[model samples]
Target: MPDTTRARIQQEAARLFVKSGYHGVSMREVAEAVGVTKPALYHHYADKEALFLAMLEGTLAGLSRLVQAANSQVGIRLQLDTLVYELLASAPEQRVGLQLASELRHVSPERRAAFEQEYRRVWVGGLSRLFEDAAARGELRGDLPPAMLARAFLAITYPLVTGAPTSDPQGTARALLAVFLDGATPRQGAA
Candidate 1:
């Protein structure tokens, strides 16, 4: 199997897996979509599970890089803003990975566990460190646990990526961050 063929297969398979659920797609269909023969696809990935895992790994790797780059900067507000904008910009690609993660339980228990562990190590672990750094810097509210705050932030802002009608994801992200950083209610101290 040539490296280019394998890469092509992985790219196309990831796209299809996002469009259709894991169970909804078949190896033969992937091969056809990639314009490769079934045997050629098999030569690269012995089975659908192998292909799926490769796609998951690639997605996780991309996400890990995105988070790490954002965390490398010091300011909590800047970090959060960078993360929000990147996530919103990459929503379509990320949505596929999120859908796969949500549906991972349908995979065999052993593989599912492995997938989950990798997800935690890459996504959750990095997030935990970033939030903890923010707290240690006294940039975040002391009353909130960094991990809890990180999850809440993600929950609150992710919808903008999926639901917002605007063309500017970055602008939408900045506004969403304002809501999270500030509050829905008017400040009592305001004149």
Candidate 2:
């Protein structure tokens, strides 16, 4: 119930979840990691599924805010660059969001659907709007549909976030951005 207990549980559970997949860790292991009894952990979270969802919700909330903030900025190029950096700069713990995303199919149908819906609503929908706005302003090529282009951009960068080493995340991010932008930008005279 206390703030510290809740924070500790989230911190420990996130660590264990990243190190071991959601199905791999048990309540007892989380309890030991947090220095709390199983009953204490249960008091805060009804079950492992509940705790996993909480961690997932928190990660998505952070990412959604980041994307929304970038979208609100003045320029589309800046907005895209900001999103790239945010995704690339995510810490190892936050990287679990990508892993969990891939593993969501293994979760219960209800939770899996819910996760996918929220992901689309937040990340995909936001990206579509950004591309549309950019195209309207002549900041991006107008030939491609915003929704399709948004999906393409996400497809290009998701792998780097999920599996690439952190040694040069920024560099990888720049290259990915360059590739997408180069294709999306209209040339001066090309039809």
Question: Which predicted model would earn the best lDDT?
Answer: 2
Model 1 scores worst on lDDT over the 10 consecutive residues at 157-166
Clash statistics: count for each candidate: 0, 0
Model 2, stretches more than 4 Å misplaced?
A: 166-171, 184-191
Q: Could you tell me the TM-score of candidate 2?
A: 0.85
Give the best candidate by TM-score. 1
Per-prediction TM-score to the true structure, in the order listed: 0.88, 0.85
| lDDT of candidate model 2 versus the reference | 0.81
Mark the 10 consecutive residues where model 2 has the least summed lDDT.
Answer: 98-107
Model 1 lDDT tens row, 1-191: 66888888987887787778788899999999899999989888889988888777877997898798788776877787888888878887776676666667667799888988987788777777788887788877778887787788778865665564458877877888788887778889886
Give each prediction's root-mean-square deviation over alpha carbons.
2.1, 3.1
